[model samples]
Structures are given as C-alpha cells and as structure tokens.
Target: MTHIRNIYCIGLNYVKHAAEMGNRVPEEPLIFSKPTHSFVKTDGNPIELPADKGEIHFETEIVLYIDKKPDPEFKVEDVVGKIALGIDFTLREVQTKLKQNGQPWLRAKGFKNAAVVTDFWDYPGTDICRNTEFSLVKNNETVQQGKAENMIFDFHELIKECDENFGLDQGDLIFTGTPEGVGKTEDGDEFILIWDGKEKGRFVTNLK
Candidate 1:
C-alpha cells in the first residue's frame, strides 16, 4: 500500500488574490488542508481531470516539502527546510459557493490530482523570501501572475503557523497559495507552472 500523509495549505497568502476575491484586508492568514492522496507527481505520467467538475481553475503556488520533524520547542527561524514546486488546481465555482455558505474549502480544493507537484529541491535561498515572480500559463497565454513578496505571511511566518497547529514532518507538503488573475481551462489545454528566475515545468490535461 502507498503511504499517505497530510496536505496543508495557506489561503489568500497573496494580497492581490485577497483583493480579487473582494475580501477586505485580512487580520490573519487563512489556512486549509487536503488529504495526502491529493498529491500528484509528473514523472512522465498523465493527469486525469475530474469528469463531474466544470471549469477547473489553476492556482500556481510555491509548495514546500517538509523534511524535518518539528520540535515542540523549536523557534520559527529553525523551520527552514526543503521545498518542492507545484500548482494548486482549484474549482472556483465550488469554492465560491462554499464561501457564501460559510463552509469549509475542502470539497472545492481537495479533489484527486488537484495538487500537482514536482520533485523536491533544497530550499532555494533567502532571496526567495523577499520577492519572486510565480506564474501559470495555458497554451502560452498567461493566466495567473504573482510574487512571493505579496504574501501576507512570508515563508518564515508560514512555516511557524503550520508548526504551531500541526507538527510538520518529512514528506509533508504545504501550498503557500496563489495570486490574482486565476481563470478557467478547457480540455486539451497545456498548462505550465513557472517560478521566476528558475526552471519551468509543463503538463497537459483533458476534460473527461
């Protein structure tokens, strides 16, 4: 049997995404989670889209792959660890309805193949904390664009918050959240996830 862990996510970490959602300035960072089975890796494998869902939206985020077991008495600065790259695929319509009804974001965010990630890489560097452009494209047309500097809670704070509630351990993943300009994608669309000043990865999905 395949081992499954936990999927932790940050909501509206990007200020522009908050504005796009018509939310007033937030008092604290928004948090959510997806099950371990939600993870998908592109090792020359095909990703299948949900047949029952409509207009699947793309939310490009910086995903951190935890490698250390969190210590109860650890300081926030000590949380530094390896991170992976990935895109957070969201069902916008479902998410909107859930929000209006004051419900949890699980159903809207935790579907199969909803979180697509790449192989883990060592923590890029401290500069990734200040400013880094992240974007997504479909068929060469950019759909979402954002910067890490726009996050309400930077990397350090994000890791701290996660540690406070749930102790992070090896193989755990955290999606920091997406930026503004998110939109829909039709079947047969080739999507690309790009992190500024780094390598870009591409994947194609079809509506089944």
Candidate 2:
C-alpha cells in the first residue's frame, strides 16, 4: 500500500467563500489539515457518498505538490514544484453544525476520499499566482466559479503559512481552497474540476 503524508487545506481563501460561510470578511486565511488518507483521486473512480452525513458538497480547488523541503524562510520561488487542480469534497451540513457547536472541522471535512487531487504538473507560471479561473460542474450543470485573484489570501502568503507550520517536503500536497457557489452532490452525480481552460479531472459518486 502507498503511504500517506500530511493533508493541508486552506479555508475561506476566497472572499466569496468567506461570505457564504457567514463571515463578514476574512481577516486572514483559514487553514486546516487532514490525514493523507483523506485524498481521493477523481479519475473515473466511484466515490461513496456518506449517507449519514447530510449534504455533501463539492469544492473545486487548485492543489499544490511541493517538490522540496522548505526552510522557515522559504520563498514561493524557492519552493519550485508541481501543481495539480482538484476538488475538495466537503460535508457542508456537518461542517455548519460543527461550527455552530464550536467543534473542530475534522470529522466533517476529513473523511476518507474527502480530498481529490490530480496528476501533478510543474507550476504553470507566475501568472497562476495572480488570477486563474477555477470552476466545477455537476451533471453538466455549472455549480461553482471563482478566480484565484478573488482569494483573500494569495498563493505566496498561503505557501508561507503552510511552510511555517507544516514544513512541506517533496510530495507534500496542499489544497489552496474552494470558491463560492458550493452545493450538494448526490449519487450518480457526475462532476468535473476545471482550471483555467483545461479540464483537470472528473468523478461520480456511488449510491450508498
């Protein structure tokens, strides 16, 4: 079996997502981590949607694959590596309940196959650091859309915070975060994650 590493996730990086999450405005990037086993590859595989969990939602995000260990002062340029676009499957109802109860987000957000990533590619270009379009479609209907520039915290800052606490090593994957317009997905729901103009990946959830 393949060994799993750390699973890092950014929350409310996008301003619109923050608003949808009921925050007036994000003061800083919300960050979270999940076990590496949380990863789910969306390449024609069947995802078992949790029945007990209400309203499982799809959050399309750009995933970063680090190629080197970063020092405390590591700069984004120094952390040259691969970037893959993917989806962050979330339990929206559970997450909201947890937040209301002031509980941790793990149980709701860190289930098996919660993090879906694609084959890593070398960081496309510095332009990706600014505005890059990311979107998701379910059953051929557009559901989510937002640009990286809309993120309250940009890529550079996100990487700095990630390196400071987690210290990324080669093969470490970080989910930048999702945008607004998040909604629930059901069994047989075919979905796709798109970055810029390229089709990143697609998957369908299996009925419980």
Per-candidate clash tally? 0, 0
What TM-score, over all chains together, does every model reach? 0.88, 0.91
Clashing pairs in 1: none
Lowest summed lDDT across 10 adjacent residues in model 2 is found at 1-10
- Tens digits of per-residue lDDT for model 2 on 103-176? 99998888888887766667876576557777888898888887777777777788778887767777677788
Could you tell me which residue pairs clash in candidate 2? none
Candidates in order have lDDT scores of 0.75, 0.77
Best prediction by TM-score: 2
Q: Write down the lDDT that model 2 would get.
A: 0.77
Model 1, 1-208: lDDT tens digits are 2233678888888778888878876677678998776788755556787867666887778887666766766543355465556777788788889989999988888988888886666676657645777677779888887777778887767777787787777667779888888777677788777776455577788667
Model 2 bad stretches (over 4 Å): 1-4
- Whole-model lDDT for model 1 versus the true structure? 0.75
**lDDT for residue 147 in candidate 1, whole number 0-100:** 74
Best by lDDT: 2
